[model samples]
Target chain A: MIVAKRKPFDEIMEMLEEYKKVLVVGCGTCVAVCLVGGEKEANILATELEMARKLADNPIEVDSVTLERQCDREYLAELDDKQTDYDALISMACGVGIQFLAERFPDKPVFPAVDTAGLAVNQAVGWYEERCRSCQQCVLAWTGGICPVTMCAKGLYNGPCGGTNLGNCEIDPDQPCAWYLIHERLAKQGRLHHIKQIYEAVGWRDTMPRTLIQPGYKKPEKEEAK
Target chain B: MSTDNGLKSGSNLEKILKAGHFAFTGELGPPRGTGAKEVIEKAQHLKGNVDSVNITDNQTAVVRMASWAASLLLVQEGLEPNFQMVCRDRNRLAMQADILGVYTHGVKNMLCLSGDHAKFGDHPDAKGVFDIDSMQLIAMVKQMRDEGKFLGGAEIEHPPKIFIGAASNPFAVPHEWRVHRLAKKIEAGVDFIQTQCIYNMERFRQFIKEANDMGLTEKCFILAGVTPMKSVGMAKYMKNKVPGMDVPDEIIERLQGAGKGKVAEEGIKIACEQIEEFKEMKGVAGVHLMAIEWEHKVPEIAERAGVLPRPTVE
Candidate 1:
């Protein structure tokens, strides 16, 4: 659930203008869920590119394909056979998928059509709001399910700030203060008293992140020795 | 005093609306199978009978023939194609980009909707991305037109004059909420509304009356949607499986009573009856024939309903 806002049309057109035959690829994963990267979107983009190009007398040829999961090696194999058809590729996947495609097809130029934002939860149907920062730690058990990282404009760890006005954030009058929501949530759970307990300062460092890392298996002695 | 006269000429949508009454419009669902030839053939069949043929992005959320390819084919064949743009699959950037692209290709009409979920269709594993609803997309388009700049502040030499159309499901779950949703679209400045498939004429007339009473009927052009139920199975599916659709028991029972060979004919007859009735109803601007898989029968349905007159030229 990556919360991403779409890029403007003119920017995309300028990118496509540089390529004559463009292969628009869509990823069927987080980007697809956010509606930025999907087969349908890729095709729509391809169509728009074709239309825009035709008007400019360039008449670009667009061939679109949607991979099941652009980040996976097996799913990315689908693009290997069709790589020769286009001069460049416009991927509708997230940063990861675009990188994977670039890694797989180093010979051809690959571009991203969507800018991947942070993880989001659907506030309602068709509305996605940023929720989590994936801080590599689970503190929700202590925070009572309210995320201060996303809710707070400053991502503050403790207490109200000068921006907190009458229980509402000064940044947005309509939004409830994150601290207020946290207080309410903790109060409902009868854990409001725990709010006073000083927790260790959080360190924001992610040296490496793996989406599908396996654990508990030791490699062969020869492989491990290397 | 002269500076106060900032009012301009009617928008492109106004030009299209003033172009004629009983303006015929039909939808083209991208094929699920490997047969775009069938889609092209059907578009050719609907060419003269309808004012514009709508190419759906992905109806029911199943992967299929691309709307842009199908629409490009239609335009190549010299037919006015209305491209159905959905926010279910793209964010605002992609949506705006695609709209501008289609406009450059001579696509005139656009029916915006928050498309169906993947769970409802064949691909259960598919992810549904609803970046923006129909209204937001409409506002984006209006912004592109009036301001001559995109949300990203990119300048445009000339913006497209696309007729902005939105969807309405008066028969949606919890009927009372439908009016509120329709009001949302109206407030968003949608030029026209094409409702979800209507089966009960009584229910449709009531919807029209209420809309007029709310002063919405006059603000936007209302096009009643009609889909011919193929058989008893389809009738049942439309009643139960189909989202945002209402199929009366009488129509279902009629289809159930009819045998295999006559079921399609009966369904077409009922749909035609609905259209004929819609033609006489006041405040009803036009009809959007969503023939679904049975798109070839659109000309027949239009002719049967007496809406066919070669779609009088403007």
Candidate 2:
């Protein structure tokens, strides 16, 4: 799931300083699962913003609403009935949802309240770790299901570099070396031959802004203009 | 030295090793800022004392003058540079472009490495571009040179003539697999190999013996890396702080035994001893003396190690 963290309170306050009234928006999907931008978080942020502004002698009005999923237009249509008196909209969703909300309400200024981290797995209630970079090309079959692109600090494509020490990364002793893990897993599975093959250089499909059209979703060319 | 048809790039280091001489090489790290004076001064120490000097590309991930540019500076100063290229900074296109560029400027040798992660360097926030690992980089260079083709299989009108080298770390984890890794590097078309700094002679000896058993030594020249520990503090730091560095407790104890005033001298003596031993070790072709930041001491170290008056080959 996509993971995000709330932006620093000071930065969020600074962005909303000019607005007299604001609406704090949240998503109910990935961000909610990660305990970052759920309805509870949005209400807490709204209360904190009201109290902080009242104390600064600049009292302002703030409201918050949590939608099912901000990325879908159908869920976003539920906001049409809400009063549109807000000077700015504060998005508490991931980057994609924030952009979608901005596009839906093009007139109101939209400020991001959370920084989208990456595609990750929830390790615990409050802890999460990145699992994939969505590099557009995956080599998991050869690497024993370990993603070197995300786990290794250098994102090495071949074997481990000289920095692998005692199965840990040179960057930090706590972080396990991705290649070392791959080697051990492959060795146990009797698939060591997979790593021996020289994997070619990554083509970097993610280098540009990527747009994927699924097989059935791509528009057909207009019948060749009969 | 008999002239053989097997000389790949005809680099000075390659020629010396191919001539059956116990070759000696040194390292010169480019400065963080743009200044040729430092590079020149450093090269002066290694001018006639070693076969060729390795110009590091942002060693430890710190920003520095490009290695190719520094290599050109060495070429201008009448010295051969083992131009180091790290996968941390460049994609294949940039790497191939620089290889061609450096060759035109008279640089001959190239060292492929997966550079230290950028998080450990000055620019911790910089994006690391490991589009290819060191193994892939070595294979790509071999393709460019031997096959006369780019990585994309396009014909190169004139490819860079490079003596390829890669780094080995026998002290890294899964010690049993180190020799296999060396064999893989040999298969990838590496002409020579320089290992990480060796303070744990026991493990390194075992690694060399395994390589010998696997017949990997016959395929490529193995240059053992040595760095003189400046002080006991540095020894402890390397043993504790630096990952993949196997500074055995015995070496640190030896450094401490040399009273505080004589630790540096003891460090030099230890390095010289390692070099002397490498000369007699089977399958060991050379010694890569890396006096980190203490380039001025290289000449003395090389002379004391009895590798002075480096050989010249046509």
Q: DockQ: which candidate is best?
A: 2
lDDT of 1 by residue, B1-314 (tens): 01122311133333445564766678887777768678778887788888778888877667777787678778888877777886657767777888788778877677777666455557766655544445667666766766777756698777766677888877643344355556667766577888878897778787888888888877888888888888888888767655445678998888878886999999898888888888788878888888887777887887888876754432
TM-score of chain A of each: 0.89, 0.94
- For residues B1-314, write the lDDT of model 2, one tens digit per residue: 11246767778888899899998999999998888998999999999999999999999888899999999999999999999999989888999999999988888899999999999999999899888889989999999989889999999987777899999999988887788788888888899999999999999999999999989999999999999999999999989888889998999999999996999999999999999999999999999989999999998998899997898987
Clashing pairs in 1: A6-B93, A7-B93
Give the residue spans of candidate 1 off by over 4 A. Answer: A1-226, B1-16, B33-36
Candidate 2 lDDT, A33-102, residue by residue in tens: 9998999999999999999999988887999999999998888878766738788999899999999898
Best model per TM-score: 2
Give candidate 2 misplaced runs (Cα > 4 Å): A81-83, A219-226, B1-6
lDDT of 1: 0.73
Q: Return the TM-score for candidate 1, rounded to 2 decimals.
A: 0.57
